[model samples]
Target: MSAPDARPVRGKRPKSGDPVVDRALALLAAFTEEHRALGLVELSRRAGIPRSTASRLAARLQAWGALERDEHGRYVIGLRLFEVASLAPRSHGLREAALPYLEDLHEITRQHVLLAVLDQGAALLVERLSTLGAVQVAYRVGGRLPLHDTGVGLVLLAFADAAVRAQALSELDSPAAATLRRRLADVRRTGVAVFARRRPAAVSSVAVAVRDGAGRVVAAVSVVVPVDAARPQAYEQVVRATALAVSRALGARPARAE
Candidate 1:
């Protein structure tokens, strides 16, 4: 719910910045959605603090086990943070109900399948199943992805609250953002996202929304196949069927046929 890093100060010199609080959080912020590991110098550079300041703060963090010094002398976020992050309530609940369907879909498709939820203005891939035949997708479980870039990401942003939706759009480029707005409207109307290659070497991704018992789109399910084998109609049918099956499993009844 809160931004990863905030300007909250504990003890401080008033106006400009607090050396203590900023450096502490800066050590933590040194780990990003991408690089979860960093050397002291790299961490210092990423956090915009001096190496000596980073070393001092990092020592305390290591003492508390919030970070650990690795074999190469680089530091990584510790297991304690991961242990705490794993206790997030929404993540615990979503997987319990949606997992069986996710497994079934993965088994059926034999491709890269994903289940993701909207979190903090980005879509987080909470679960993923990759088959041998599947194309190599950039997505990883627990990774944060841009909402306008991936199939599941689009659906989650499409039905998100207005402020979150606005934040998602702001993260996009102007032309791509405009394209996404129109694409989202279509996803809402059609209830599916068929994301195929717009250029060479892109994977074909097809996705659909999954509703909970309350009929809200709590998560999105998607499949990625090789673009060379892309058949929009075929992928669309399989994705819709799997989504409907999953929805019913979650106790969501389909709207009557139009």
Candidate 2:
């Protein structure tokens, strides 16, 4: 028998002194929207770990309630992970303050309502609401959107720090760079962003900034509608109203009318 404090020495541990914590995290990261449930073989392949190592690590994760097995014996992400992730102050606090306004907008438009924040040089979608027959969009909660695309991404980029703006601009070609600069200038002047895309489906997004108590643009609220359903401009005013409402809920003062 081992001492109470002694770590388990069972199984053939990796001989290279690999970081077990990172390997464990990799196992968790292997699960995605398209691959929510995975057998041990697929999980090992996706995580790039040896089958035996994966089995050992998976057992530990299961014991900690970070993973669960479905009736089919495939591993699934556990509720304990969500319970922990829900405590992240940024996403949790912002979602709490924005959900009611988001729901109101959703009910009014019956379209996709998005709330996203700047994270890791991209717009991280924190919340989304959609109806049964709403237009399908590629974005999902917890997904990162490009800063140079999407209405919320553009709004966040427009209000981002100068250094971040430069980094994003530097990645574009000369002509595209010039066009984006002009667009960013317009977004800053109007405090709103309108972006349209044709691929997957023709849709337009109208987005406006959400501010925090300190008057900083902390998030963006947007409504996505099919091009044929309504002109993107038609929803601009309502989207702006929703954004302002969410901002007020976050302790931001209302902007004085021009």
Which candidate tops lDDT?
2
> Which pairs clash (backbone N, Cα, C closer than 3 Å) in model 2?
none
Write the residue-wise lDDT of candidate 1 on 103-189 in tens digits: 877787777888888888788988888986576777788788778878888888888888887877787789977988899889888
Clashes of each: 0, 0
lDDT, candidate 2, 82-149, per-residue tens: 88889886897899989998999999999999999999899999999988798889999989889888
Q: Which residue runs does candidate 1 get wrong by more than 4 Å?
A: 1-22, 166-178, 198-200, 241-258
Whole-model lDDT, model 2: 0.90
- Each prediction's Cα RMSD? 5.8, 5.3
Indicate the worst ten consecutive residues by lDDT in candidate 2: 1-10
- Candidate lDDT values, in order: 0.78, 0.90
Instruction: Tell me the TM-score of each prediction against the true structure.
Output: 0.77, 0.88
